[model samples]
Target: MNQLNYEEISTEFKNYFLNNYRNFIDEQIKEVKNSKFLINVSDYTSETIDEPHRIVTNFLKEKNIKNHRITNLYKTFEFEFDFYLLMLTFDERRKMDIELYEEIWRHNQKL
Candidate 1:
C-alpha cells in the first residue's frame, strides 16, 4: 500500500489503542495486582488474558518473531501486555520495565 493508506491504518490502530486498549490495560494491571488474574477488559474475550498475548503474538508474528517453546513463561502475555502499554505510552508521552510486573504475569499464568 501507499504511504497515505498505511497512515490511515496506523491512525486507526492508534485511536483503537488510545481510546480503548490503553485504559483497558491500566485497569487490567490493577486487577491483576488485586486479584490473581485479569478480568476481560476488551470485548474480544477469551478464557485467559490471551487477548493481550494474541495481539502481541500476532504483531510479533507479522514482524517475523517467534519461538519454538515458551522458554520463559514470563515472556509471553504479561510481558507482551506491559510492553504494548509502554509502547502506547511512549507514543503518547513513554515507559514498563518492571521485573515485578513480569513476575506477576508469570505468576498468574501459572495459575
Candidate 2:
C-alpha cells in the first residue's frame, strides 16, 4: 500500500479497536482498571492476510492478556483470538493497560 493508504488503514483499524473497547468499558457497571486486545497480521507470500484472530492470539501470548473477548474474520486452518477487552472492574482495566503496550510494540514492528 502507498504511505497515505497505509496510514489511513492503520488509523481506521486503530480507531475501530479503541472505539469498540471503549464501548465495552462503558457497558460495565463498575469502572475498568485493566484490559487488552490484539490485532495480528501474517503473510504467506509477501502479502498480508486478514487474520485478526491470529493477531489477537499472538498479542494475548505476547502480552499475557487473560480476560478479553475477540471478534475475527474466520479462516478454517488457523486459530482466532478475541478482539475486545471488557473488564468490568478497576483491577482488570489496570491489567489491560499493562498489556496494551504489547499493541504498541506489535504495531511498531510493522514500521
Highest lDDT model number: 1
Each prediction's total of clashing residue pairs, residues at least 3 apart in sequence or on different chains, is 1, 13
Candidate 1 scores a C-alpha RMSD against the true structure in Å of 12.7
Cα error, candidate 2, residue 54 (Å): 10
Question: Runs in model 1 with CA error above 4 Å?
Answer: 1-4, 36-49, 52-111
Give lDDT per model, in order.
0.44, 0.37
For model 2, the superposed segments whose C-alpha errors exceed 4 Å read 1-4, 29-111
What TM-score, to 2 decimals, does candidate 1 have? Answer: 0.32
Tell me each candidate's TM-score: 0.32, 0.25
Per residue, candidate 2 scores C-alpha lDDT tens digits across 81-101 of 243321122354444443444
